[model samples]
Target: MSNSNSTPLMARVTLGRALRRLRDEVNHLTLADVAATLSCDISLISRIELGKRNCSQQHFTKLMDLYGVEESERDRLAELHAATREQRPPWWARYSEVITAEYERFLGFEAAASEVFEYQVGILPGLLQTERYARAVIGAGFASLGPDQIDALVEVREIRQRQRLWDSDQPLSCCYVLTEAALHFQVGGPQAHQEQLQFLLELQERQNVELKVIPYAKGEEGAQIAAFRIFRFADDDVPDVAFGESVAGSLTMDDPRDLRRLHRLFSNLSAAALDPDKSRDLITRIKNKED
Candidate 1:
């Protein structure tokens, strides 16, 4: 609802509608038929038809072939996918070389998200990261990337940060819950990490953004094991999604069951984490400790 101007959602909806229309025209395959072909569940197929799940590249390809779609239509769908991935880097930074192919895909989806909710148990999400911090994290994580690749990746990352300008028909709204340990973890040395925390404090004041903290003392309840981000599209038709990452790659889930699980986790996290004012205070405390 916030992104009344965003075209990505509309594009997604248009694709879903087209997919459904094509299916209907061909004696209408049951959910089972699509699921069997995609190696997913019937419910997932239903969600995809309803525009709740993002269409994967492979799925798009298969569907086009199956429906004998016209070249023009295929091209339009492809354009939508590419447009959804486009981003403008920050004026001061560049893309990162350490970024893997999977993360890049996730970043593309993030760029077009109408709203994002993140639960971070370790480090800050990339959107809230500063150039220095992001560089340090990327460089340390992947020592193999050549400087050229790293530079290119950093530029891409900076461009992705322009999600701030997200002003689609459904503007982006983001909520983040950061763990206390992430504050004192001392990533990129004291100064860079401190600045990152400070940046988070400033970012909290922006419209449509909310930052909360899960203090160390909160114990088990505050210790949500992994980090995940949920992206919700603006169009009424598209389904919401949750993305999870591991050391090597990440996975995206849009199944109704999976989405429901993530939604519940977010609700619990929001309740357990500190409110905005308190979260800001905690970050300030961490920054002052550095001083």
Candidate 2:
């Protein structure tokens, strides 16, 4: 069995997709064929292609040769494989006990994303949330977690914001659409909520950030849609990913059909939302009302 962690790493996912595509579209090879060449079981090939199992170096090289991957592409795939074998854990690995494997994967994707389109309801998106607001939200949502665990998760959020949003040399372009109700919801009580709105106003001034709000008057425009985010990577080899979460669990979808649906949903929501200038105005109005 290939030595691989149970948790899916972002590079592994990308590599798997690339390999799968090459198998299906480029090489027109079947699992059985590849397995026979490697003298391994078809299931093993399937798992490696699905990213559930890591591809060994021998198999990787053999597959690349079989696929007739271009020199440049071979170099890229080699780097991805090397990344999968990285000895150092990601920054969020310390909080692993507190966060789900899926969430950890999400942090990796979000960190690497070049752009993010997020639609949120009920509360502000994590990137836009204030520390106190995040604390309250995390505490209430994860009531079973101990105080320390909650604190660790909050710190993870702060680190994510700093690295991805505030401190990055090329900060990811972010487009956020939130329901008006999110602004009105007093998540961390009046003071924290007010601060959160003020922070939103400040973030709106950022060149790479775009904030919009869907007012109640818009009615059902975005009412039925759950919160979700679409992450776009700079690497053309990696496809865009659509992620949604609820109390049940989180889901990550990269199928072209799903991506198209989410893109359409986001486009409609953006159309229905207030423009950035008006969004700032409404947020200011709400903040003043809180005071």
Off by over 4 Å in 1: 1-14, 17-28, 31-101, 165-171
lDDT of 2 by residue, 1-291 (tens): 111221236677778888999999998989999999989999988878766678899999999999999999899888888877777777888888998978976887887788999999888999988999999999998999999999999999999999888888879899999999999999888888888989999999899999999999999996955899999877676678889978787898877999999999999999999999999999999999879
Global lDDT of model 2:
0.86
Taken over the whole model, the C-alpha lDDT of each candidate is 0.73, 0.86
lDDT tens digits, residue span 104-197, model 1: 5466466557789998888888777888988888787668888777666666666667644343334468888878888888788888887888
Model 2 spans > 4 angstroms off: 1-8, 41-43, 70-73
Clashing pairs in 2: none
Highest TM-score model number: 2
Report the Cα RMSD per candidate.
Answer: 6.7, 3.9
Instruction: Indicate the worst ten consecutive residues by lDDT in candidate 1.
Output: 1-10
TM-score of model 1 relative to the true fold?
0.72
